[model samples]
Target: MLTLLLLIPIAAEHKPLLLERFRVIDAPDPATRAAAIATRADEIDLVLTNGTVGFKADEIAALPRLRLLAALGVGHENLDLAAARARGVAVCNGAGTNDDCVADHALALLLASVRALPQQGAALRAGIWRDALPLFPHFNRRRLGIIGLGAIGQKIARRAAAFGMVIGYHNRQPRADAGEAVYFDSVARLAAWADDLVVATPGGAATRHIVNAEVLTALGSGGHVVNVARGSCVDTAALAAALRDGRIAGAALDVYESEPRPPAELVGLDNVILTPHVAGWSPQSIEASVMNFVANVEALARGEPLPTPL
Candidate 1:
């Protein structure tokens, strides 16, 4: 039987299913975890982890029997892809498993930021009858620009369409199904053209800091930005500076450059909306992600290619 190291804790509903076929082990300490992995190198054939909890290259080299490395979530930004490819190890991710949930959360951030919902809610709690007060900024007929036109971007595009927003996008290659939206060959050009920007590209070196000061400035004043993609895709320091200096109108983000803990600069910003890095997490999305991983594992065991191979 193949030994699988279940890096993250599995839900109770899925625990029985995992333990039935493979020898599963959980580690309470990081050193103990590394030790367990190293000690069982010869017997372990698969490693299950998320992008944030990827196995290092040295760890991979130690595991002679390791054949497959699976990312439980869509973002594999931290995974060492070059090493995995060099070792002939198959890497797979649960792409599209949580796209709907992420898109929904992106919209939540967009609406909240655009309409200043948080500030409005705060005013209401203080018994301020602000109906006659000036309403917060809105997107209205503004153009929404998306950086990536993949599955997640497509979902965001569909939602944007429902809001009567014009859409534009920039990608490595032009997509034939982008509908009525125009496509830009460069990110800067796209930002220059869009009134609001939502980044939905994959996370990796290729996409790191795609939204920098130049892009932010190009987005121009009275523009809003939303990010449901990897945090590395945006320059947080630049974004914070822009927000402080009014270089841009406002921003909303579900992911930060330094996640789990946001930058100190953003903590006091009234124009920015922040949430923990959980845009892709929902009850339904969790189930779909787990099932996708299980399907990949089962396919691998049967000597078949993964449905969403990285």
Candidate 2:
């Protein structure tokens, strides 16, 4: 039986299925995780981690019997892919498992920000009416720009299109399958052309601060920005400045630089909406993500190609 070390938390309901398949070692707490790896380094064969709580090079080096590393979600940003390659440890992730959930949340944020739903609702609670509150932009007939044209971005585009919004996107390269959507080579150009911007790009050093002050400025004062991607993709300080200075109309974020803690910079601002990094989290998505991990592990055991290798 393969020994599986879990570095990320799994829901209580999902734990039983994993326990039935492998000799599971649950150590989500950082200190306990370190102790587990040190004590059972030789026994561990497969390791399950998320994109944020990645398995580093040092940890990979310590595990002599490790053969496979799997991320519960699409992100593998913090995963030390180089070390995994050197050690011949196959890496896989649950790419499409949560695409629908994430895309749904992205659209929800976009609609809320563009229409100032939260602010309006708050006003009503404070004994204010629509006449006292500032009028917000309509969601329909606006230009929507997406930073990434990946699986999730494409889904967001389709949803936006249903609302009568014109779609545009920026990617490292134009995708042939993008369908009717206009493509911009640079992020700045995309922002300039768009009335609203949605960021769905991957996170890492390369993409860190891809959406900065300049991009925010290009988005213009009438525009709103929504981020369902990694927080590192947008500069938090810059976003706060933009919202404060009216560089952009408003903003909404599902992910921010501060993971567990709230983003201190934008929390005071009323124009911006924030949700803890839960855009991709839902019962359906969680189940699919766990099942995807199980499939990858089973494929690894049978020497079959992984469904979603990173």
Candidate 3:
């Protein structure tokens, strides 16, 4: 028998069968998370955490029997990889499990921001016709630039093409499948060329603050921006300042630097839309992610390499 602490609640509806083999810990707070680990240190053979709230090196050292660290999603940005590697503990993530859900949310945010749907809805609820208020813009034939041509970005591009938007992207190396879309060598150049910019990059020190004040300013006053990736990919302070001074026309975000809590600077901005970091969440995706974790765990127990080791 093994003891495992789940950092966040998984989909209860899926009825994970591994429950009988492990003890589940629901730790939503720092104190509670640490407390659970401390109390069950010796018995915890596995630790379950989302990509964002990863297990620390010291935390790993505390648990003598920790054999695996299973991340709930593709991102393991906050994970202590070097420490885990040094300890010889296997690290696995739910790769490709939630990409579709996140891509769907990204497109939804992009459409809403560009069409000014929220503002339009609010005006209608206040008994003012759209004609009386400022008209919301259309997205037809607009140039949509995507940053980072990864799996999620590719999915977004496919969906955007259906809406009649011209697609372009910036990446480290040009993807052969990206033949349908134009490729830009630099992010700043891509922003200048696009009427709207979508960010789908990974997070970490390498990509931190890639989208700064200069990039936002280059997007210009009539340009829209959508971020469905990591919050650190774009500087929040720069984004908030851009919205304030009309450096960019509008912005939509589903992830932030400080999650579960919305940014204080963006709270009152009508031109910006904010959501809790739930871009990768959906009924189907949640179920698949849990199943993926279970499969990885089973593989680890059998001394086989994980199907999707991160």
Candidate 4:
């Protein structure tokens, strides 16, 4: 049986499924991870991690026999792809498994941010009526720009269709099948054309801070921004500055620069909405992701195509 290191946290209910297949070790915290790998590196053949709990280069060096690295979520920004390639380790991720869940959350953030739902709800609780509150924009019939035109971005576009929002996207290259959604070569250009911009891009050095102050400036005071991708993709300081100066109308995010911790710079902003990095987390998505991990592991063992390799 292959020995697998479980670096990503799993729901207690899902633990038994993986444990039955491989000799498993749960090392979810950073404190225990290095020590666990150090002690069992020779025995570990496969590793399960996520974008946040990424397998590092040093960690890869420790595992002399490591053959596979699977990211439990869609984003694997933290995973060292180059290191994996050097070691001839197969790399896979739970890509399409969580698309719907993340797309749903992106739309939720977009609607909430545009309508100022959370703000108004709080005001109502504080005894203020609708008549006393400032007016907010309607979510529908506006231009929507997606920063990435991947599976999740496409799903978000389909959802936004009901709201009559015109969709556009910015990818490294224009997609031939993007259909009616306009395409842009630059993120800032996409932001300029959009009334609301939703960032669904991958994280990592190539895309880090892809949505910086320039993009925010192009988004303008009438624009709202939502991020459902990796926090590293957006500059937290730039976002905070934009909100402070009204460079953009408002912003919503499920992921920020601070992972497992809230971005302190944004805590005081009334024009912003924040959620824990849970855009792709739901009981359904978690279950799907776990199954995807199992499938990849099984395929690796059998020399078959991986179910989802990124």
Candidate 5:
């Protein structure tokens, strides 16, 4: 039986399914995980990790028998792809498994931020009425700008379209199948044109802080920003400043530079809404991701191409 070391936390309900197939080693804490890897290096043939808790080159080298490295979700930003390539280890991820869940959350954040739903709800619960509270704008018939035009971004665009939102996007290059969504070459231009900007791009060096001060400035005083992608994609300090100064109306985020901990910069701002990095997490999505991982492992065992190789 192949030994699989899990560096990310897995739900207890899902452990049985993995245990039935592989000798699973569960170590989610960084210190515990490192010790476990060191002690059982020789036994580990497959390693499961996520973008945030990435597997390093030295860790890859420590396991001579490591044949496969799998990311639970679409992101493999922290995974050392070069090391895996050099070592001839198969790399795969659950790419399309949680697209719908993430997109749904993105739209939820967009609507909530635009309509100031959370703020209104809080005021009502505190014994305030609509007459005393500030009125927020409608979410429909506004321009929605997406930073990434990938699968999740496309899904968000589709959902936004239903509400009469005019879609626009920025990418390295315009996609051939973009259809009616207008394309912008630069992020600032996209923000300038959009009433609300949504970030759904991948996390990495190339895309780090893609939404910075300049882009936020272009978004104007009435604009709202939503990020369902990596936290590193948006500069937290910049976002906090913009929100505090009323440079931008409001912001919502599911991910931030600070993981497992709240972003200190934006947590105190009433204009911003925050959720732990769980935009892609749901019962349905988790089950699909786990099954996708199983399928990839089976494909490797059969010497067939992986369904979603990175």
Candidate 6:
């Protein structure tokens, strides 16, 4: 039987299927993670981890027989891609598995920020009348700019159309399939041109801090920013400064610089909307993600191509 190192948390319903297929060794918890991983290092043929709970290089070094490394989510930033490549390990991720969930969450954040939902709720609870609070920007008919035009961003655009919003995007190259949507070659230019900026790019060194003070400045005081991508893509300190100085109107973020902990700088700010890094998490999404993992490993066993190779 093929041995597997299950680093990412597997749901109860899916656990039995995976356990039955392979000699699964669980090491997700802190207490058992290191020793468990070490004990089975040489025997593990495949390792499963997530972007945040990424498998390390030293851990990779330990697993001499490791044939595959898969991230349960779209991001595999924490995984040492170079090292994996050097060792001829194939990498894969649950790319399209949770696109809808993440897109829906991004829309929720944007609408909440645009409508001042939190502030409105706070005022109502504090006994303030509706007209006493300042008016919020209308979400409909506004210009929406997405940083990445990948699978999730396309879904976000599809949702945005229902609100009668005009869409623009920034990417390395213009996509012909984007149809009527305008494209910006640079993120800064996109921010300047857009009324609201949405980040949908992946996390990693290439994208780290791509949305910095300069981009925020270009976004102007009337523009709002939304990040549904990795926290590292945006500079937290720069974002905080921009919000505090009113350089940007507002921000809605599902991910931040610190994983597992809220961004300390933005948590106290009224102009920003914060959520736990659950933009891609849902019961349905998780099920789909696990299914993707199962398909990848099973394909590996059959000597066939995986569904979503990273």
TM-score of each: 0.92, 0.98, 0.95, 0.96, 0.98, 0.95
Model 6, position 286, has a per-residue lDDT of: 90
Please tell me which predicted candidate would have the highest lDDT against the true structure: 5
* Tens-place lDDT digits, model 5, residues 167-261: 99999999999889999999999999999999999999999999999999999999999999999999999999999999999999999999779
Which residue pairs come into collision in candidate 2? none
Q: How many clashes in each structure?
A: 0, 0, 0, 0, 0, 0
Instruction: Tell me the RMSD of model 4 versus the true structure.
Output: 1.4
lDDT of each: 0.85, 0.93, 0.86, 0.90, 0.94, 0.89
- Output the better candidate (2/3) by TM-score: 2
For 183-244, candidate 6 gives per-residue lDDT tens digits of 99898988888889889998888999989999999989888888999999899999999999
What's the lDDT for candidate 1? 0.85
Tens digits of per-residue lDDT for model 3, 1-310? 7777778776667646557666766676799988987787887888888768878899988888888888888889878988888899999998899998988998899889988889888988999886797655566788999998899999999888888889999999789999689999988999989999999998889889878898898899988888988888989999999999999989999888877788888889998989888889898888888888888889998989898897
Error of 3 at 71 (Å): 1.0
Candidate 6 segments whose C-alpha is farther than 4 A from its true place:
29-31
lDDT of 4 at 51: 84
By TM-score, how accurate is candidate 5?
0.98
lDDT for model 2, on a 0 to 1 scale? 0.93
Write one digit per residue (lDDT tens) for candidate 2, span 1-310.
8899998887788787789889999899899899998899999999999888889999999999999999999999989999999999999999999999999999999999999999888989999988887777776789999999999999999999999999999999999999999999999999999999999999998889999999999999999999998999999999999999998989999999998789999999999999988999898899899889889988888999998899
> Higher-TM-score candidate among 2 and 4?
2
Candidate 2: regions farther than 4 A off: none
Model 4's TM-score against the true structure:
0.96
Residue 249 lDDT, candidate 6, scale 0-100? 82
